[model samples]
Target chain A: MDHLVILPILLPMFAGALLLLSGRASEGFKRSLCLLATLLQLPLAIALMAQASGGLQVYAAGNWMPPFGIVLVVDHLAALLLLVTAVLAIAAVVYAVRGDDLLGANFHALFQFQLMGINGAFLTGDLFNLFVFFEILLIASYALLLHGTGSARIRSGLHYVLLNLFGSALFLIAIGTLYGVTGTLNLADLSQRVAQLPAPDAPLVGAAAMLLLVVFGLKAAVFPLYFWLPKAYAAATPPVAALFAIMTKVGIYSILRIYTQVFGDTAGPLADLANGWLWPAALLTLVLGTIGALAASTLNGLISYLLVVSVGTLLAGLALDSHDALVGSLYYLIHSTWVCGALFLFAGIISRCRGPRFVGRLVPGPALSRPTLLSGLFFLAAISVIGLPPLSGFVGKLLLLRAAETGVAAGWLYSLLLGSGLVSIIAFSRAGSTLFWRTDPAAAAGGPVDNVRLAAVLALLLCSPLLVVFAGPLLDYLTITVDQLLDPQEYARQVLSMQISTSGGGH
Target chain B: MELLYALTLGVLTMSGVYLLLRARTFPVVVGLTLISYAVNLFLFAMGRLHTGKPAVLGQVAEHADPLPQALVLTAIVIGFAMTAFALVLALRAQGELENDHVDGRGKR
Candidate 1:
């Protein structure tokens, strides 16, 4: 069981390599191979999740000890994200199998590589390794974003690639500076060294920390750095966009992990280095993202902006920096990732139904073929996104609001959060009415929708209801996760104290 | 020696930024390359300006740091791949739009 911790990373790599090498294979063969690998991740993630519930389980690569060799740490948060990634991979692959994969060669291969990168990023305990995994995921994304290239995708891809290249440069610079000052790239080791840092190194470390924030900010699609997101995501083929729903959260995850574990409250003078910038950034991101959603010209555009809004909300949850808030944010993180994915998938369907002439354009064209079922699903997803009751979004928001309880901070958070919800309601409503209500009764709806794609969309959207049903146990798990996260001392002790039990044949 | 190294990195980065801000794809690619070169140098420098020092420990009293060199190598490889990809994509964009403007707009 302990050995299986690295499977999440290895499985995808092997599958991806196989898919890539099987260049001459039939479409059916490729699709089944990709689907089978994706499905297998579910049980693997669940088993890891079960194992992680006990405590921090570390897997030292190549039988090396901590602070020396690379380690993969599995806590509840990492395992939970692994499960989310698996679920999303399945939904995305299922959708892509229908026809999108044919748009470009190596689609399955690229998809699996990206998953491997994402899984590695989640599990890796070394800072340098994190950067490597980030590059892997990013490079894969660069190709995937331009897959099924159109004028729109190519144009947008150009900007996306360049900006991210710059971002990557910043990331390397940051990692270098930290390694220079600390002499170690291991997270747990850094936690201890940072706590006892001599006074002179503070400024350099502080600068590096902020640089890291900027890099992650770009990835998370936070305000001011998020210009690339709407165009890139909206222009992508639906399955790629759906899979990308977790990409920004990877930034959020890094922020959560690094801030809590490596530079938590115990780090002498650097105690709250990031919180000050983070809090205001989160608020501004939320406000601007809401407005962007309201102003979107197309349904895909609207969904993309809604995603930006989710990033904002989740950031605010993190910025709140309280245990209860963290739990709420974690729950919201899961809910938003799944819901945004569902919305992106649905956006593809909506565009298809309206035909090439009205591909995702918000204005009405023709009535959809499956008007009732489609509209119902859209309504549920919209309500969930907008934080309406009997859905997961409301529960998430309620938990956050409860955490904010009565103060100047509380007031600000409440208004901003609730205000964003109102604006989202307006945005989704306008889109719904424009696309669904104002449809032309006489015009012909497009070709019959693919059943497999529709089923994939349904599966992702259904996570909203599923989230609500299981919210109680999920919140409890998150509470423990947060507690684990906040205790940097414990994490450091546990990780650094780990000894290599299986002695290799050596002197 | 340290001053010369620092100035070289600074100049490279300065030119990189300048070209990066240009509206054309070719210059942007050049700019990215130059900047990556600067970053690699900067990363290498983080290990300090050591001459004739062994990187391995327990041999010499004063040893150089080997970690930053490894990091720089990884960066260079990644930067190479990114540059190649960027060049291909730029070419594709140029052919598609028949212009080199980064945003696919009229020649600026």
Candidate 2:
């Protein structure tokens, strides 16, 4: 059993703890240390992804058997997400190091702790442990969201904190109910138990499943629960908002992971329980998110709504619940996380160039110092986000559109998916023109752009075309990932049958 | 006994929710704390309430389900920390924004 599985979680835990204690250290030292840890994570994630491509790998924490102790399970999905997170971390940390860290105390430490929580959430196999990791990540996020203090951040922080605390309470009730009914909290064990659940217990389990969906939906920014996201993400600093691109995906992952594993097709009466509810929510989320994008007055607000739109797209693909649709959803998930993250950094850059008076407000402002370079980057990002042909977003949407089944469902999927694409084109172009083309000629030219921050933006922005480059191999890997996901019994067999052969070492 | 326990949990949650929905920050924080208490109790009750049962196994025939107890402990710690954060955030918002309204707008 390779202990490499735990390194993703442990590396950041230790680094974050040390950084937190050494808050008195110089910024340069903290930057190097933070950069070193984030840089180390990329190769580690790739190695893990390679290892995961072979099959499902489970690491029993503390050498305890699966049903009794906490376990970290890495499959194609987990490994792929870990790599995405690592790449995004490099971008976010690089951006934060360029003066954003100085704007707040303990930024580096909070960042690492955030990564630890995210990585743990991605890898955990136990339901209770998932809640623990959720709190860990949420706690880190509350502080990070309030970084670079402003009245806007503080006010948004209050709502974000209060709402998530309520959500946390609900999450515990769901976990407690599931444990009460099934007598187990291990996801694999719960799946097995759910399959044999008595008729009476099924309703209780169903209720619990709904509560879990509500909590995850709030986190994922589903239609009704997504109200807090736009304000909060827009108010957040660039790097923090960039890292949060993966945060909503964390909710999407939980929805897919838990729903598929615990109450999937094999769970008999309770199988696919949440799909009925998720279907409408996914569609409404799409419509509302697109409208929000169109109405957004600020550049960051536009990007934030676009993030909600991505969530809607991904959730729709999941709600469609077919193999190909899932493939598209997963593909789109990666594209949106990276490109959307880069867009947040773009907001930051644009705000800087626009000067203090106009911060990417979709209005005529001072002419940019580097209009060609900045506009060129904006055009590339806008095109990619709008899902134009030959980019990663285009491919993901194509797969999704192709996957929609015939009849009312396909009609809705095609119209809405394509309609949103067209509307986004308009929204992005309007914002783009106002930002770059409609600048006031008389005003002073904006200051020279920061190269360090630009490099950070390039790191994530470049992945759009890079994903297109790797589309073939990536799709093939995702094909296996989706199929592996559809089969829950194989997962249960592997996890539940781990015998305690060596007492300490995993069997 | 079960009815009373259930009512107590319900009241805490209800009160917590009522306060949580208030416009002011202080009441909202208090409401969140109340909900946390309800959640803790509910989690503890999920293991099936028992009297005079030992938490440890092998000490007595009627050892309680230790898992919920353990889960409750974790939930309590998390809930406590979150409440403190919420209270401090409320205070800071009050100080920074010059009002305690959750939305930061003063009375119209």
Candidate 3:
């Protein structure tokens, strides 16, 4: 009955609709409204996260019962992700306001709509509703990706759109198969039904589950399915790309939700299905992503590849399917999303300070405006990203590697993670030296970037060290979250237990 | 009825895949549209393909599963929106780049 479960979604949805309708408003008006809305979201998200830590909170839409009406479930994992998303949402909005808003019309509205989709996707407890939210976010992203009109944006955006459309088709097919076999779309109901599935229907359900994996994998940008990511992401405008850093996490989130909650070891033959292939594929993704990062000539390309690396690392941990591994991945998930968001925005500012033509290339350039701040920020981000000690990235990597010490593919996990770290160190060092140390003294500085942009970038960058500072409490929280996640029957009981009371014996 | 539905679904999906693998945006769009149609039909069939049965409650001892119908309806609308957006993107790319190839290469 806690209404907070749906407020995050509703607040953004209404704000977006209002922004669209008030077409005559000044950009400043729209931007301020958006800023206020996103700022308000932080407190709400924190409260939700706090409440969910105690127990699961379910909100049935329109007071209808679960398994019949749509429900939004806020468990610990969803709550944690909602908080991470809100943080990035704030950063992206601030950046858009400072500069990127000029690129297109109704930027604030589309931004809010994007948040609504993301928040909805994170909070919804129904599979069909998840699909709806995916489309919502995708449509908004398609517009945002093309926010700044350019040949490169349009070209990459087309491929991005088409690839996702194909993925959506696959998603629908999966949902239909699941529904046919299980007769339910509510995630809790689906979990129960999957547990008791008839033997004859096992293959059908397995096929559906595999199909769902492919769809989520495409979104998460796992190994073969990730071809659409680098170009598409690199082509997006900075704020949009920053928001997209979390989009891949949504795929990871769904994989965690569906696999652990619905198809865990209790689902007969379907038990541990993803395990056979997930770890190998995740290692491949890590290798490929690191290689891409090392070979990338442009900083944007490098960061895009690094995003893939983070996904790989997180999925590798998830594939391990142990409490320690899931806990480590969860920590890494929070740390990586923030760092990636900060880095993307920082890369944008770096590019802006360099000439447009020289944006993000490793070649030497004139000293940028705000040389000290930009270089310092870049150094900190580089350290954090490369997993140097005394920063958040190191903590995440340490936990993951430590967790892997007790897993089956300990060698592969440790080697790939360490190797990826080394490659990133070299790649970042080279790019840093090229940008900061190798600068030409007499070459003219690019135009002065606004102070607001620097603040926006710093806001996200500062969170990395803050994570290191608060690692004690955060790790404790993640331990409980993972404990909750590993026990699916408890989750099912909490979700469905409400059904009996809420239904009031109506049936 | 089941065999007929299965055959139609197979044909649609096969052709959809054929167009999807093409080098041009137009064919890809058509392929996407066809695939979505197949998926919609497939979802509708998940309700078990009852003929002449009302989806309304209490209409008979047996009724069609209303949930998949609702799901299909929603999917169709979303699919339409996706197609429109994609076509516009393709048109814009074609006009801007002077190419309709999916890759947007000028000479390819």
Q: Which candidate is the best by TM-score?
A: 2
Candidate 3: clashing pairs of residues: none
TM-score of 1: 0.98
Query: What TM-score would every model get versus the actual structure?
Result: 0.98, 0.98, 0.98
What DockQ does every candidate get? 0.88, 0.93, 0.94
Off by over 4 Å in 1: A505-507, B57-61
* lDDT (tens digit, per residue) of candidate 3 on A184-240: 999988888888888899899999999999999999999988888888888888888
lDDT (0-100) at residue A450 of candidate 3? 76
Candidate 1: residue B99 Cα off by (Å): 1.9
Comparing to the true complex, what docking class would candidate 1 get? Answer: high
Clashing pairs in 2: none
TM-score-sorted candidate list, best first: 2, 1, 3
What lDDT, from 0 to 1, does candidate 3 have? 0.90
Model 2 TM-score relative to the real fold? 0.98
- In angstroms, how far off is A432's CA in candidate 3? 0.8
Count of residue pairs whose backbone atoms collide, per candidate: 0, 0, 0
Give the alpha-carbon lDDT of every model. 0.91, 0.92, 0.90
lDDT of 2: 0.92
In model 2 chain A, the worst 10-residue window by lDDT is A498-507
